[model samples]
Target: MRRHELPRTHAAGRTYLVTGSTSGIGYFIAEQLARTGAHVILTARTAGKAELAQRAIRHSWPQAQLSTLSLDLADLSSVRAAAGHLATFADRLDGVVLNAGVLAQQTRRETVDGHELVYGTNHLGHFAFAAQIYPLLQNTLDSRIVTMSSYAARWATLDLTDLESSRAPYRGFATYKRSKLAQTIFAFELDRRLRRGQSSVSSLLAHPGGALDALSPKRPPMPVATTAQVLRARPLSLIAQGKDKAAWSAVRAVLDPQAHGGQLWGPRFLRSKGEPRQERPTAAMTDRVVAEQLWQLSEDATGVKWPSLSQPRRL
Candidate 1:
């Protein structure tokens, strides 16, 4: 059945969980989903941010079904707790947007789990959370896990020996890019596993092309770039887009019927910023060897794995 198109039944609406919805592209993803009358769950590092995001969504989409959960992806305990709370909070889950992530830190940082902050929060944390909630997602009739990735993934190269970049020189931007690449690899690997298991759950990826805060719309409660900044960004609009518009790709992956597992959704213009459409990922993005390796490393690092998916087969 098409849950997205289904009438708002008395039982409840299609439930979608969007992480890091307190601001940036994550907020927009949650907001857009709420606008469709879906019961959107917003997650932030703290209860305050979550509440803020929920309020902002409610203010604009008053009728929009909304809830909030505190999730600190930098901490595995928090991810587990949030997933536990999430499983109990909702009876059904239609989709999950893994949109929460730290980007472009000026200095290299480590997560509470002792891994690189960028990789830990963006990839490993989500991986563990997804595993924690795998059963809930499986119970849902048809569910999808849409990963919010980046164009930086294409430029990334993984050093499995030093996934944390401790041994290697670490540029904050380079670490961030590698983290996105790791997560992107995980997304494809997950889809393959789901397909192999014949599960109803699907995994997909979306990248918001060159999203800039300066180009985004002012949503009131949330902060926005200054008028001067916006004006200065006008010339760059040819290639970049506002964060609000950038969110459409992830939103489409979460709810669009045509969005299938393993497919990438991105911008139409310059493949970065425009209407959401099917995007062609580069060869590196779909490399199964690296994906398989990353999956093993992720399972080992997170100490979480899907029990039913232990066939020991590679595609």
Candidate 2:
């Protein structure tokens, strides 16, 4: 079953929020969701980009129910404010996608909150933002939360002693990989928490392989600038799977009722080309005990308590 080829069902009254929707894989996801008649909130750091994306969608689907929301994932305060504002406009949220992330950057940098740029935007900011929208997701029927992880995550490992990577030597690619691994692990942890609380929402994890698109503004700088420029100039869309194909992995995990929770999906070809396939997390991701500890550590680092999961569910 292909993602775009999946059954076309109307999501008339349903609402979805897609971060980093202004460009790349996230943009395509938002466009497809809008086509299905979802009240889609397309988010980006700048209002200009957000509006441009909204307009682009409307141009294609005049009746597309899309709105722009500004959110800077690199900054925790910005994330909190954006999530807060979203709550006021929507009564319930059916889908939430953490699609924004930094790619390969050459330099080591920190966000406004003094956290590493890659980890801050890709993990901490999203981790906290999702927690803030706890209530809205709870109110929906069979809600879904999708977080994007990359195949590069295979190389990522958790450094308990240096979770922030401040103590250890920093390599650009290594940092990105580590953050992606955290994203997958965090998804599993979120699912566990939701189930424990008896919440209907299912937390899902996915990734777009070497798809041709940017993620978020806070994306890591390209480690190999020359190679990137060469590839771009050559218009190498032929070399990798299109962004649309890559995004299917996410669409399947989010919409397919039969799909399992806490699984990763990627393309079959090298770097995820062709149709998406099921991918298991590394042994590190399956370690429930470690996942729990990591979840706690993330909360502590971000200073965001998951209010929705604070109390046990009363049957």
Candidate 3:
């Protein structure tokens, strides 16, 4: 687990898609998979960003097989277009790391479809994208989707009536936590449906404790850092680790063949930093009633359905 050493997955035909791969934990997830000789598709809001990420990965491992797609989750049209484009090339998807999303923003925002920006991008946008790509996953046995959630979600209070934060007061951090909770609920619900349908596809969740860029190793594709800046963040290293270490759970969720659906994997200690391990999900994430409510809300918002589910009405 050193910076220079790469884990050997020995995956050649395995195809994965990592959203928000331009930087942070997502970038490292793509990098990890690429190093193992896996085929990866790095997604970004624009074709240029995606291309740059592809080049960045290849620059390190010349044998890396990578592709790029332009996907703007804030725009429903863009999600549809990206899914369509992906279907043309990716006949099957072994796994997907749902990592693209905005963190806490200073002010409330809205997506192109008029939904609250944070919930729209982090939850609903991924909801649609996951639904659209469900067919590809179905085509591949044992395919899975790994959702990236946050420890902060433990602080959220779900008010389904004001799910969009339109009527409720919006504290940036609190609202962001709520969005993570929604997605976590969505992941569990998808796992339940996958089970009911008896499909081999799985849905799992993974989260980082607290990721610090300064503690992360510097690479040419990412932003440059000053020595002073690295030292300034050293005190925080006591609790948090770099995005490289934070990405371990996600990579395990993606590559572990023995992994089952409905399992939560995360950093080993205090939900912060260590090896990836199976962990219990918070009660809110596993509640069936709340998950069903969010699932309905997602379907209504996204106009996408899981083709595998024959009874999408009740489940």
Judged by TM-score, which candidate is best? 3
- Candidate 3: lDDT over CA atoms? 0.85
Best by lDDT: 3
Q: Write model 2 residue lDDT over 1-315, tens digit each, in one string.
A: 653374355788889999998877887788778877889998888877877787777777789998777799999899889888998888878889899999766777899999888988899999999989877887786888999988888877887666666854578888888898888889988888777877778888888887754212212221123555545635555546656667777776766667765667777666556666778678877678878888888899889988865333321
Instruction: For model 2, name the residue pairs that clash.
Output: 102-219, 102-220, 103-220, 104-221, 104-222, 105-220, 105-221, 105-222
Candidates sorted by TM-score, best first: 3, 1, 2
For model 3, how does the per-residue alpha-carbon lDDT over 137-212 read when each residue is reduced to its tens digit?
8878778899998888887877898878886467777779999999899999999988888887889999978788
- Cα TM-score per model: 0.92, 0.88, 0.94
- For each candidate, the alpha-carbon lDDT, in order, equals 0.83, 0.78, 0.85
Worst 10 residues of 3 by lDDT: 306-315
Q: Ten-residue segment with the worst summed lDDT in candidate 2? A: 215-224
Q: Please give the lDDT score at residue 65 for candidate 1.
A: 87
lDDT of 1 by residue, 1-315 (tens): 232231222324688899888999999888888888788888888777777777777888788788888789999999889888987778878889999898878777898989889889999999999888777778786689999889888899888888887864568898889889888888988999888988788899999998999998877677779889989999999999888889988888887676789999888888778887787787878889988888898999989886574322221
Q: Which of the predicted structures, 1 or 3, would earn the higher lDDT when compared with the native?
A: 3
TM-score of 1: 0.92
Q: Give the per-residue Cα lDDT of candidate 1 at 72.
A: 92
